[model samples]
Target: MDNATAKNIREGLKADCTKCFGLCCTALNIVASSDFPINKPAGIPCVNLQNDYGCQIHSHLRNKGFKGCTVFDCLGAGQVVSQVTFKGQSWRENPKIREKMFRVFPIMEQIYEMIAYTAEALSYDIPYALSDKLSAQLKEMQSLTKLDAEQLLSLDLVMYRLPLNKLLTETSKYIRESLIAKLPGTKNSKNYNHERADWIGKKLRGKDLRAINFRGAYLIAADMRNTDLRSVDFIGADLRDANLMGANLSTSMFLTQMQINSAKGDINTILPTHIERPSHWIN
Candidate 1:
C-alpha cells in the first residue's frame, strides 16, 4: 500500500471518543485490582460513564483509582461499533439492542487490533511480496469492521489474529536483522525465561537494544531509562508500569496508545510522532 493509504489506515485505527458511545467503558468487564478499584460486569455502564457517553472521571481516572480505564484503547472500534455496526443508534436510543451491542463491542475490538497491526506491517520497507500480503490482509480486516453486530459476534478471532501475528513476526525479523544483527550481546525477546529471569525491575541501562523482538513479553515495571529503543518491535508487549524515562521510542514498531498509557514515561522520553507523551507522566 502507498504511504497515504497506510496513513489513512493508521488514522482510522485511533479511538475517536466524540463519535463513540463509551463502549469500552460499558461493554468490557473490569476486575478489581491495581488497574481498577471496582468490579464491574460486562454490558454494564461504569459508574463514571455519563449519559452523553463521556466518562465522568475522564480527567481524573487514575487519581480516582481507575488506571485500567486509562490504559484501555479500543483502537477506533467503539465508534465503528456504535456508528457503523449499529447504524448510529446507541443502545440507549434502542434499548432492545443493548445486549447484542455489548457482545459485538469486544469482538470488533479484536478485529480493529488486527487491522492496526497489519497496517503497521505494511508501513515498513519490506519486500514487495510481504507488503502485498500485509496490504491484502489489511483490506480483508478493514472489510470485517463493517460487518453487522451478529456477523462480528460469530467470528473466530484466532483465524484472523494468527495469520496477522505470523506476518508481524516476519516483519519484525526483517527489521531486526537489518538493524541490529551484527551488534554484540543482541538479545532474543522471546527467550524470556532463559535470557531474563523476570520481567519487572529490569534495568537495561546503556543497552544497545535496537531491533529487539519484544513481542508479547511481560515488561511490567521493567526499568528502561535513557535507553535507545529505535527499531524495537513492541507488538503485544505488556508495558504496564514499565519505566521509559528518557527512553527513545521514535522508531519502535507496533507501539500503541494503550501501551503508552500503561507505561511510565517522562518529558525526556522520545516517542513516535503519532504517540503523544502522556500528561500524567513525570515531568
Candidate 2:
C-alpha cells in the first residue's frame, strides 16, 4: 500500500471519543496503582465518566494518577461497538443489553488493535509478497470488525491472529536486517544501550538509534530532538515527558499509541503516519 492510502486507513482506525460511548472508561476495570487512582470493576462506570459519555478528568488524567487512561487506545474499537454493533444504542440508554455490550467491547478492541498493527506493517517498505499477504489479511480483519455482535462473540480471534502475527514478525526481521546493513559501520557502530538505563533528563539529540532494543528502558524527560530512530524497537520504553521535537520515528518498530501519548512532542516531532500527536502537546 502507498503511504497516503495506508495513512487514511490508519486514521480511520484511530479512537474518536466523540463517536464512542465511553467503552474504555466503563467496560474495563481500573485497579489502584501508580497508573490509576481508584479501583473500579469491569462492568462499573468510572466515577469520572460524565452523563454524556465524556471523561470529566480527560484533560487532567495524568495529574489525577489516571495516567493509564492517557495511554489506553482502543484503535477505534469504542465507536465500532457503539455505532456499528449496537447501532448508536448506548449501554446507559439500553440497560438490558449492557452486560453483552461490555462483553463484546473488549473483543472488538482486540480485533481493532490487530487491524491497526497489520495496517501499520503494510505501510513499511516490505517485500511485495509479504505486503500482499498483509494487505489481504488487513481486509479480512477489517471485514470481521463489521460483523454483527453475535458473530463477533463467537469468533475464534486467536486462530485468525496467528498467521498475521507470524507475518508481522517476519516483516520486522526483514526491516531490521535491512536497516542494520545501512548503518555507519558494519560491526562497530555506537548503539544506544537501552537495557534498564537511566537516561532521564539526558540530552541525546541527533543520535542514530536504528534497530536498538528499547524494551522497558527509562527515557523520562530525555531530550531526543532530531534523533534518527528508524527500526528502533520501543516495545516497553517509558517515554513520559520525553521531548521528541524533529525526531523521525516514522519507521520505528513496535511503537504504540500508549508510548506516544506518554511522551511530549510538538509539530516538529515526525511520527509514524498511523500514530497522532498527543492533543496536549504544545504547538
Cα deviation at 190, candidate 1, in Å, is: 14
Q: Candidate 1: where is the Cα deviation over 4 Å? A: 181-197
lDDT by residue (tens digit), candidate 1, 1-283: 8866786677566789999988888889999999899999999998998999998889998898998887888888899899999999998899999999999988888888888778777777888888888888988998998888788888888898888888888888888778765665545543322122346677786565677678778788888888888988888788888989889998898999899999999999999766767778999
| lDDT score, candidate 1, position 84 | 93
lDDT of 2 at 207: 80
Candidate 2: tens digits of C-alpha lDDT, residues 1-283: 7746765776677789999999998889889987888999999999999999998888888788988898888988999899999999999899987998998999999898788778777777888999889988988998988898889899999898899878877777787777777777764566544657778899989987777767568999999988988887675578887888889898787688888988888888888766878887779
Error of 1 at 34 (Å): 1.2
Score every model by TM-score. 0.92, 0.83
Candidate number with greatest TM-score: 1
Which residue segments of model 2 deviate by more than 4 Å? 1-3, 187-206, 213-226, 235-246, 264-268
